[model samples]
Target: MNPTIRSLVVPVTDLAATKAVYSALFGEPHTDESYYVGYNVNGFEIGLNPAGNGGGPVAYADVDDLDAARDALLAAGATERDAPNKVAPGVRVCVLADADGNPIGLRGK
Candidate 1:
């Protein structure tokens, strides 16, 4: 699939409090764990990561080829915030920073 921003991850200091707020807005989460909590708001994902990004939410663009896409972004001056890692079976994710230090996440199969 072409890259599209469909997933958003927010780093939180207080998981319980933040989870409550998101739950109220988006209903119950589809995936819940101590490391990560994810809600499926329609097709898009609203995630709460207690130990993810330090700043704001990171929007993830779903891509077909993770390595190729990441390399292209690096060539265009996007710095690597995090290397590609598998979060689930057949699913890999990585974070990159644009020129302004804004995070950009990529997820692929």
Candidate 2:
């Protein structure tokens, strides 16, 4: 499977406040905002996960075979927060944390 880091989720308390700061820094408004506000910085997406329980920044990586990757992580001592499932058309993912509790989002690309 070809895996590449895609979007990174940055946990924040206030979306409005963070958005303003990011906008000024990047010199561009967010490209879209829904469940999460997303900004396209160059080719990478920097997102604000306001309601995330992860408590830190998360790296969402693009994977060709999410199930395979999930299995590999599990075998290598990672715990599943959610099983791989389709979240949208042509898109699916799951959250996994290594032994140290850092989040890595395996995504459909």
Candidate 3:
């Protein structure tokens, strides 16, 4: 696996307000995908996903092999949810629940 984060998606209650805050903090928007707004900081990508649909603040860990990453995290005390499945057509993810029930996601290209 590459073991590098491709992007981090943050679920916000107020889309416009959050976008404005991130825009100010990052200086400008790199890309906006309607469902998502991306900002580049150095080389890392941050995405803002609108609230609803069981969405929440998501922490992403990018991996060359999403399945492998999911397996490893599962071995290390993280509970897998929905296995490594596609969130969108090309974007794949493994949903995990931490010891405290906090959500963490491993993403793959």
Best by TM-score: 1
All candidates in order of TM-score, best leading: 1, 2, 3
Worst 10 residues of 2 by lDDT: 26-35
TM-score of each: 0.95, 0.83, 0.74
For candidate 3, what is the TM-score? 0.74
Give lDDT per model, in order: 0.93, 0.79, 0.76
Q: Which residue pairs clash in candidate 1?
A: none
Candidate number that wins on TM-score, 1 or 3? 1
* lDDT of predicted model 3: 0.76
| Residue lDDT tens for model 3, 1-109 | 5576567778777778989999988977877766778888888888887742344667788777787778778899998654666767777876788898788888885
Model 1 misplaced stretches (Cα beyond 4 Å): none
Write down the RMSD of all candidates, one decimal each: 1.1, 2.0, 2.9
- Most lDDT-accurate candidate: 1
